[model samples]
Target: MTTHPAETVHDALREEPCEDAWWMPGPDGFAACALSSSARTVAEARRFTRATLEGWRLCSSVAEDAALVVSELVSNALRYGAGGGGKEPAAVCPAWLALTRQDGTVLCAVSDAGTTAPVVKVPDHLAESGRGLHIVDQLSDAWGWTPPDRSGKTVWATVSSVRV
Candidate 1:
């Protein structure tokens, strides 16, 4: 079995909005719950990702990669999807992150109010920010976007299960 840092996991769970975020029995013999949240800033995005990954008992390397992907996705939402003016906003739309486990894969999904789909651009050294999805494309086993039934779109990526 994979041994994780218990104290860190507990602390992160305490901060989640829902007690149970993602839960499913692992094919290998274990269960995991992944909780996610969203932020208007890159810093908050990183914090939320770190907390969720730690809570899920992801290894250091996987956690780091997941964090980076979350940062990019959240940043894109704040920039294009949500009406974040970068200053004090009169109102903010609900943005969220969700984790789910199915078929021995851990899926990380981010939802936002924007209808625009993410496009993977060819890597450009001079461009400032279009490379986010490109990186996600390379790291995740599979990634895509979907429109929610009510509103908004969800972009999701999958990671192979670590359970043993």
Candidate 2:
């Protein structure tokens, strides 16, 4: 894929999955996966996320942050995405995650078929819900989402290896 220098942030995030199909063109490395929207698939995605970060020799801090991002993204996909006949409506939605190391940052992107953008809610102290995107925003250098060309959208984040 030809990466345009002036591409929008949405384009950049969408392109990462396709660009990272095998590996990225960088010194670090890349990992990509097309996951089924199922409970078992979520577990698999977690493993894949860990392996991908470790394979790239990312710092522990980056890896940990990436893991959390992966978990939240995958969980959101399984919950809101179309797959798994587990109490949810049946729709064919493919979920994916891609990781790439660029310059001094590690970029992670997760794509799913839900067009509704994710929101970071202010959860009450006693409530045991929400806070996924909130944590991602606080931990990563940057985080955002993109609507794909056809359907679905991708949520992405970047974190620096070194503490800022």
Candidate 3:
């Protein structure tokens, strides 16, 4: 279920973990879910994202970009997020993925238990590393990360949902 922005302002002030329904409406024009920490999670997230976008009637417009965004975000979370602890570098950390619509804008957010903000680095054209956020910046209308609270931070991007 969705609440008007003004009506939810007070609730928004209280720091809360990113729940499946965060900033979304009920049964229409919104969806969210948690992603398990696993190497395969990125691929699974991409598939889930495409299906969800299709169910929301947005696949024809933003499915490709959304899939790429989901993949990169989840991969980053698993690679550098808290669960790895810089020891078990291959471990995947629990993360959350959410989608919401507001005034013709579709927001895609990935939450992980990492306090570090994502960095956008300029990668050499031939380089294979450090280009995820750059790709996100190129594809989404806008992108940024929320400061971590008790649960962690959420990196989000917004894309226009209006099909041209």
Candidate 4:
């Protein structure tokens, strides 16, 4: 974990074996943690999102929504944001989950080592999978994916809970 002032959240992760998990309270209202592109990271990411939001004194609704978004984003990253053309090994494919607060909103983003974009699929009750992005769409006020950089792409969602 690193809290370097100028470094972006993606810099906090490296494509190496995730021997241990770590978290960082980054500069300017940002916090991030390192994760591996594995199924287990979904639970871990949701937990981290809740903890970070609590630490930031955010509302429960925002925390809940953010946690769900974090789970979907991390799951997508692990499932789709992996493999092919220099993508790191699955066991150690580095991923990062980040949160940043701006007034009444919290931004949840997951960055991974794959360049593919996230697509929202039509809901099919019969299918066991392919509903992650739809959940993200329903929960987040706004969500989208960033184009791939040298390392990979980032999918982000925002949840706003401004009380009167």
Rank by TM-score, descending? 4, 3, 2, 1
- List lDDT for all candidates, in order: 0.57, 0.64, 0.67, 0.75
lDDT (tens digit, per residue) of candidate 3 on 1-164: 23354533213423433222223322476666556664556766676667666666664558778888878888887666646334342233367778776655678888877767887777878987789988888778888999876567889888776633
Residue-level lDDT of model 4, residues 37-105, one tens digit each, is: 545577777877887787788889999989998988888887777552454443464677889999779
Q: Kindly give the stretch of ten consecutive residues in candidate 4 with the minimal lDDT sum.
A: 8-17
- Candidate RMSDs in order: 8.3, 9.6, 9.7, 5.9
The parts of candidate 2 lying over 4 Å away from their true place are 1-28, 83-93, 148-150
Model 2, residue 122: displacement in angstroms?
A: 1.8
- 28-104 per-residue lDDT for model 1 (tens digits): 42333332233424555555555655655666666676677777777776666654233222133345655555544
TM-score of each: 0.63, 0.71, 0.72, 0.80
- Model 2: clashing residue pairs? none
Ranking by lDDT: 4, 3, 2, 1
Error of 3 at 34 (Å): 1.7
RMSD over all Cα atoms, model 1: 8.3
Looking at model 4, residue 155 earns an lDDT score of 90
Model 4 CA lDDT for position 16: 38
Off by over 4 Å in 3: 1-26, 84-93, 162-164
Clashes of 1: 0
In terms of lDDT, model 3 sits at: 0.67
